[model samples]
Target: MVGRLRARANASMWVAPALILVLVFIYYPIIENVRLSFFSWSAFSPEPRPVGLDNYRALGSDPVFWRALGNNIGYAVVSLVFQVGLALVLAAVLEAYVGRRLRGLLRTIYFIPAVISITVAGMLFQFLYDPHIGLVNRFLGAVGLDSLQHSWLGDQDTAIWSVIAMSQWQSIGYTTMLFMVAIQRIPAELYESAHVDGAGRIRSFFVITVPMVREMTTLLVVVTISGAFLAFNEVMVMTGGGPANSSQVLGTWLYHSAFLNDDMGYAAAIATVIFVITLAASVIQLIRAQRRRVET
Candidate 1:
């Protein structure tokens, strides 16, 4: 018993550093952020003044806040459609039909954009969306589609969607690769058996492939939604939440309120909202996963 206690102590000691880091960096910041949300403060101010729920109440009345939240929801919806839904289909196609060598090459080509820095990607797309010298406008004009060309990022109507399009280009490949991995894990014999039973590829995909990849789908859904809500760098680099705040998302709005506007408390409230949303997504994922485990 004494020797077992010593072994457990040693194991705990090995874990202590990581635990301490999480407490200091992650948990502490989360707690501090929540605490700060109830106070009115600025970086220049010596101390935070307790304001109760004033910041959150202010959020309810803020038009820009609503606009930013709506943009986030829109972003989430688009990501779900393209990044998760379309990517899954693409992954199935690549896995089921493509030759091995071609599959590897295509995956690498697609995933290349995901590896590029978001800042770099954002700047590249910003240049591409340029009204005057941009490749997009240039291509449209060259192809006799000049009527379709306009200021892509400069206009409020197309700004958010333009950013979202760029995001889909960068992200779809990564999600497709993840789905492909999940598909690969499925037993080959199952596909062979389905083939023997007269199942076409499409029928087999729906019956076998989709069900087998449920866990990956759930994970990707939660992650995509969380990331959509947390979107910042792309919008910042491309639009700066602008064209009259039309493209603003929750993250950029939080940054605007805190650093630019010197309203740290309100930013804290915004942060709290983001935290709640992401936490809820994670919780839902966990519950679904647990339920699946129970069913199995």
Candidate 2:
């Protein structure tokens, strides 16, 4: 009994640091966030008084909140449609036609964004969107579509699209490189056999490559969806969720409340809701993916 206890104690000593780290970093903040969500706290106030759901109630009536939700959904859909689809297509091309040198060069180009900070990307794009002197309008003018060039980040109607486009551009390279890597791992023999059986490039791709990369595609979908749901930094730095709050996402709104507006408790409530919604969506996707696997 003594030996067993001593052995167990020795084993637990190795886990002690990890447990303490988790308790301090993850568990502590989570508990505090939940606690704050039930109160009304501000930096100015001497106390964080218990408000008990008022923050949530306020969210129910806030049009900005609804707009943010709508924007986030739009962002997610657009990203899935353009970002991941573009990646998959590029990956397919690289797998089917590209040589080793070209593949290496393309891989380098695609990975540039993953290496750079998103904040720098956002700031760089802000300049490119400059209405009078910006590169976008300049291109439009040079192309004779001068009328089409409008305020990219400042105009209400076009600002959201501009931000979404920048985000897609930033994210696509990383995703394409990853997808291409996944596609490369698929057996050359499989393609050779398909070719031997008289399959064309498109046919072999659809018949073999597509099915092979389904797992990778699922993972990318999950990551893209999560990032879409939590998009904040770019919008904050680039747009400030502004031009009449046109591009506000839940993450930016939460930021404004927690840090800018000093409504820590209300921000906590929003964060909790964000967590729940994202969790539910992820669970649904997971269930659907499992069903898909079971079917095949």
Candidate 3:
């Protein structure tokens, strides 16, 4: 009993640092933000004043907030389509069609952008989307589509989409790599059995590959959704939520309100909303994963 107790005590000591860090950095900020949401605070002011639900009430009438929320939803949808969907397709094609020798090279090429910092990617895209000197407009003109070339980042209609495209470029390869890893783990005998059953590549892929990678697909979906909501640095470096706030997401809007508009209370409310949404998504994902584990 004494030896067992001492061993468990040593294990507890090893975990204590991580537990303390999580409490201080993660839990404390969440609690503080929640408390701050019910008050009126400005950076210039000496202290926050309790306003109960006034900040949240103001959110209901805030058109900018609504626009930002819409943009965030749009971003999540786009991320799902391009990041998760495209990555799955790419991984499938590579695993099924591409030769083993070429696959590694191709994967490295695709995954390069994922390693590049988002700030660098944002800056690079800014140059690419530049109205006068951008490669995008240049390519359009080269293809004799001059009439179609508008300011990519400056136009409200195209600004958010441009950001989405950049995000896809930066992330799709990472998603593809994840899916590829999962796909590679699937039993090769399953593919052989399908082939002996006279299944074509396309049919085998649908029947054998897709179902096997369900857990990876679920993980990517949750990650992509959370990333879409938490996106900030890219927007900050790219649009600054501009072209008249058309590209604003909840993250950038919160920054704008807190620092620029000096409305920390409203910003806290926005943060709380974002937290609830992401937390709910995480909880749902956890529950679904647990159910899957139980069934399996």
Question: Which candidate has the highest TM-score of all?
Answer: 1
Q: Candidates sorted by lDDT, descending order?
A: 1, 3, 2
- Please state the error at residue 215 of candidate 1 in Å: 1.3
Q: For each candidate, how many residue pairs have backbone atoms clashing (under 3 Å)? A: 0, 0, 0
lDDT of 3 by residue, 1-296 (tens): 99999999999999999999999999999999999999998998899999999999999999989999998899999999988888999999998889998999999999999999999999999999998999999999999999989899999999988998999999999999999999999999999999999999989888988889988988888999999999899998999999899999999999999999999999999999999988898889878988988998
* Candidate 2 residue lDDT tens string, 73-130: 9999999987778789888898677998988898888778877888999998999999
Residue 260 in model 1: shift from native, Å?
A: 1.0
Model 1: lDDT of residue 47? 95
Question: Which regions of candidate 3 deviate over 4 angstroms?
Answer: none
Worst 10 contiguous positions by lDDT, candidate 3: 281-290
Error of 2 at 231 (Å): 1.4
- 83-150: candidate 1 lDDT, tens digit per residue: 99999999999987899999999999999999999999999999999999999999999999999899
TM-score of candidate 1 versus the correct structure, residues matched by position: 0.97
Candidate 1: list runs displaced more than 4 Å. Answer: none
Which candidate number would show the highest lDDT if scored against the true structure?
1
lDDT of each: 0.96, 0.88, 0.94
- Indicate whether candidate 1 or candidate 3 has the larger lDDT: 1
TM-score of each: 0.97, 0.91, 0.96
Q: Kindly report which residue stretches of model 2 are placed more than 4 angstroms away from their true locations once superposed.
A: 1-11, 292-296
